[model samples]
Target chain A: MNALWILAVNEYLDGLRNRWVAAAIMLLGGTALALLLVGSAPTGTVGAGALEISVVSLTSLSVYLVPLIALLLSFDALVGEFERGTMLLLLTYPVARWQVVLGKFFGHMMILLTAVAVGYGAAALFTVLVSDSGTAGWQAYLTMMSSSLLLGAAFIALGYLISVLVRERSTAAGAAVVLWLIVVVLYDLALLGVLLADHAQQIGPGLFSALMLASPTDTYRILNLTAFDSVGQAAGIAGVAARSGFAVSLLLGLMTLWVVVPLATTMALFQRREL
Target chain B: MVNAAAVEKVIDVAGAVKRYGDKTVVRDVDLSVRAGEHMVLIGHNGAGKTTLMKLMLGLTRPSAGRVRVLGADPATAGAGRRRALGYLPESVAFHSAMKGREVLAFYARLKGIAPAECRSIFEQVGLDRAADRPVRTYSKGMRQRLGLAQAMLGKPQLLFLDEPTSGLDPSLRRHFYGLIDTLSRSGTTSLTSSHSLNEVEARADRIAIMKMGAIVACGTQAELSRQAGLPIVVRLGVRSGSGARVAESLAAMGKIHRRDEHRIDLFCLGASKMVVLRQIAALGEVVEDVDVMPPRLDDIYSHYMENVQPQ
Candidate 1:
């Protein structure tokens, strides 16, 4: 158990000191700053609740940034140990092989948790100070930030699954980045384009909603919009989409599934691997 | 608990074979070790010593035959057997993220040493000062010391050390052999593999000379010399200009090798001892001092290794 926890702590430290973690935090911080300074009250725009805007923006921020960081954090988990010959030390211990896998999974998760706390915490603090919004917006922003952390953790585990599945760190890193891009960035883009073209009229009710929940990032977006109905009213289509089925409870369930399933897969693969 | 009498066979390897693709790394080989003995395995590079150790540890499986470590087949050895044996791998790296103390305690826990003994064990290993620092900050020798400490865990009955003191300096190397000797006296069986053949003869009670996946020779140092049909050379130092004349007379009278001007190596042959002494006295007055052994292991090893090549 000490071995397990130590490994986890090391994984967490990797995230704290890693350049990728800094980049993700900077990207999120910069986006929050830009949103506060640039995105502002339009002429004659009424009913702009600070609560609604902050919630919507944070949801967007975490969905875009957290998964990217989480993916980067987890992709090199086992390969690095194997390449550097530290695996021999771990193996000499009488600890069962399964413990090693689960321990590593927990360690990488702690790192993901730390990253979300630091990056999202900074964003929230910045928004509260700069945004002219009232207490209601701050409350909504906090809620969005908390849920986004949950969503990010799910994908970080997903990256761990990929790392264990691939034998090389470089390949795992590439696969993780590609996975983040496809799932977080392009999945919504493709869905939005398809919905606008013809699928929006042709699809069954809640079909797009069902497809969107397939992605934890999309589920996070949906949860955010629905949590702040005022934002749902303004953004029109996307706002309404966010307000629907993927509420907090639904997103929680999906995110939990994301965390467990990939972590389990990684453990299984790790147990059977030669190293 | 095992009966003390049954410990004569510390390690039993029979018909062991390992193959990677078309290459047979280790072929059918049988070797055995006994209790309270310091056994050294010596071979040239690519001789499969490392592979054999890995097989014994169950880090790699044998394609054929059985390896019984401490009387239980390593492939089928339970947790109990694994706990009794301490293994030091060739490249024993540490978890850099962990502090030295943390690493020691962690390994101690795995070895199932009671928590109360952890501090003493750490001190015994000479890692008390740098214990709090992360292993990433440790020097290479420090890391090797830590590896030694880990192998010393559980007071291992059968210690398998692969290049155990590779990075250690002379003083530490002396300290290491002292530790091994102490362990030997305590009745802990050890099979130490090293490339330094000359070095092992000093520490090992018995040396198993290996070449190309087979044991070429196995016996005590004296037994090996006798097997190689060579004499154990004793150096006799004499005084002044008479040393050279004494050396020549001794050589003419009996079997001897001239090492230097003042020194002559005496190899007793099929002759009476008084004859050699009389021959020495005939040349000049005998020297007051006598050095019995003059580093005979190297000469014997080179003789045997060069003479016999394992198929």
Candidate 2:
């Protein structure tokens, strides 16, 4: 445990000094603020609450942005160390292989969490002050924040999986970008195409919801946009939400599963690797 | 005689074989290092020095045999037992963004040493002044010194250093070996691998010459020289313009090669050195100066490496 903490702390310090965490926070916070400003402008004319509109825009933004940030932050976590020759020095220490994996995962997760909290938290605070949002708006906004973190963790784990499976840092980086495209951009497009082509009533709502849970980004989308009636009505997913039977807990559980399974696989592969 | 039981074997490898895919990096080899002994491993590239070091350090498990460090299987040793060991790789790397002090403190914590102890270690490696500076600004030698400092943390019972002095200057290399000498005097067993035989030749208590994934020779300098059977070279400097005369007089004594107008070299076997010297003395005034060069580590290493290579 002590060795784990020491390794984690080292990684955290490395992240802090490298300034990527700060840059991520700035990027996320800046984009959230911009979306809040642009998104709330229509709330005054349309009579919709500012916080509700902001949550809708932010959910869409997170679906595109959070996974990219997570991948960029973690794609080179293991392979970079190997290329730099630090891993060879690190393994000679008394720490186990799993500890190194877990420690790095926790450290990168902390960075992602901090970025989400500070960036989205600032936007939420500003929206609450300027808009006449009640308790439900706050609850929905908080849910989006937490789900964004979970989505980021799932991708970060994916990045680590790539980091360990590939032998070169450049290859891992390439794989990470391709994975991001497949999961965040292409998966939803493919799902929509499938739904459109099922004109003969072949794929029903049950199969559709199950398919939505396959991608972590989709699970996060369902959790924030469909789990609550107010957010779902505002985000225009109410029709799908009424048809889907996935509970809020089940969606969150799926997201958590995404985080664990890939990370566990990374640990197993790293243990068997010669480095 | 000292009690044999009191003496400890820091590292033991018997019939160890390491293979990556179809190519074997380390063949069946047996080696052991006693406490406080400074053993140097000399080999050319692809000679399996690094693989042997990896096996002993538990970075990789041997494919065929067992390895023990500090009397325990290093591959399966617990953290408590592993804490007794330290290693400095051939190319040491650290987080470039971290300050020198922070880097040392991080490694110190990993080694279970207090962060405060990093100060003395920095001083020991002569990096105290640059301790507050980031590692990116450090020179190659300074980084190597920092690596040395990190390995010296917690006073490990066994140290495995590969090319430890590769980037160091002459004076720093001397100081580095001096530090190793001090550690060895206090009973720290050291197994260091190097390509430069001259640097470690005088300092090593025992030398192991590796060739083609196998140890071809292992012993002290004198023992290896005897095993290699390489002849010593005796150079005679005669009075100006008398080199050919001296060569002729010493022709029957040994194989004499005239170097120039004033110098001639005689190659004689180890056992016939004294007899040849007596013959050189018989020339009296003909010989101006005499110098005998015995076989050094490089000669013995080349002899073994050459003999071990397949024709």
For DockQ, the strongest prediction is: 2
Model 2 achieves a DockQ score of 0.58
| Interface RMSD after interface superposition, each candidate | 3.2, 1.6
What are the runs in model 1 whose C-alpha is more than 4 Å off? A1-3, A9-52, A118-151, A165-172, A186-216, A219-235, A238-258, B1-10, B70-85, B95-99, B109-127, B132-134, B223-296, B299-311
Give the per-residue lDDT of model 2 (tens digit) for A1-275.
Answer: 39888887777777788897899899999999988887765564433466666778999999989999999988999999999999999888888889999899888888888899899889888888877664437777888888898899899899999999999999999999999999999999999999889889799767887788888988888888787777777777778777676888999899999999999999999888885
Model 1, B110: alpha-carbon shift in Å? 4.1
**Fnat: each model in turn:** 0.30, 0.70
lDDT of 1 by residue, A64-154 (tens): 7778767766677677777767676566556555666677667666655555667666766665565565454555566676776677678
Residues B245-301, candidate 1: write the lDDT tens digits. 666666654467777667777886422446665655565456745654433777777
Instruction: Give chain B TM-scores in order.
Output: 0.84, 0.92
Q: Model 2 over residues B18-134: C-alpha lDDT tens digits? A: 999999999988898898999999998789999999988878899998888777777777766667777899979998989899888888888889888889888888999999999
Cα lDDT, all candidates: 0.72, 0.86
TM-score of chain A of each: 0.85, 0.94
| Model 2 pairs in collision | none
